[model samples]
Target: MALLNKYVGITTSDGQSHDGFIAHVDQDYITLAIPTNEMYGQMNGMPAREATYRQFGFFPGFFPRRRFFPRRIPFGAVTGLFLLPFFI
Candidate 1:
């Protein structure tokens, strides 16, 4: 359970890679906190835009803000699991 709550990368049997925080783990599956970039306006089919705050010194460059949603992956389908460095 050392990987719990840690951001990590996962490769599945189908050869697809996924990145997320290890939210929960159990006997059969592992849940990942998948990051999504959905905001107030974006959900309404409007073009997503980042609001920059020069006074607050907040510049969302390459990595924009993210919200996490849980996704469950069965252990049987996992081909690889590794740790990754994540910063907000």
Candidate 2:
């Protein structure tokens, strides 16, 4: 769709707003690539040691590194979608 690959803010039916890049859009859902810092703030406690290590590349992987956490939002729950001016 028009929003694919763009940074965006999404407001869901529950009134929660999520900011991320629109990675994929299909008939049923939109997948957003949420920043790691944003995902950390949403979590309940400090990240586990292993998770931190993985995030910071203490361990190696064959695939390319990922900087975002992928989240799929249902189309029916999306109330608003707009561009977000994010500075990295």
Candidate 3:
């Protein structure tokens, strides 16, 4: 999947609206990195933040499915029939 760089508006636990750039995403979470002002004493702590799985929206597309490989061949005897002709 492609990494996206976009602004997202999120409502915090305190019922505040925060807008920030999305830094990374996973199956269950998103990381938002917000820039701080120089006047805020250099913003000592981490700038990036995280949100829950349900906070974001998705665009319409197909999701990938698990790959399955057949374990048993119905006719093991016929396998040689299909390959033997190629060798001859």
For model 1, how does the per-residue alpha-carbon lDDT over 1-88 read when each residue is reduced to its tens digit? 8889999999999988899999999999999999887743323322345463333343343333458878899999999999999877
lDDT of each residue in 1-88, candidate 2, tens digit only: 7778899999999999999999998889999999763223222333455457566544323224347988999999999989988776
Which one wins on TM-score?
Answer: 1
In candidate 1, stretches whose alpha carbon ends up further than 4 angstroms from where it belongs are: 40-66
**Candidate 3 C-alpha error for residue 14, in Å:** 4.6
Greater-TM-score candidate between 2 and 3: 2
List per-prediction Cα lDDT, in the order shown: 0.79, 0.77, 0.36
Kindly report which residue pairs in candidate 2 clash with one another: none
How close to the true structure is residue 13 of candidate 1, measured as C-alpha lDDT? 100
Write the number of the candidate with greater TM-score, choosing between 1 and 2.
1
lDDT at position 55, candidate 1: 37
Which whole-number lDDT from 0 to 100 does residue 84 have in model 1? 94
Give the lowest summed-lDDT range of ten residues in model 2. Answer: 37-46
Per model, how many backbone clashes are there? 0, 0, 0
Q: What TM-score does candidate 3 get on C-alpha atoms?
A: 0.35
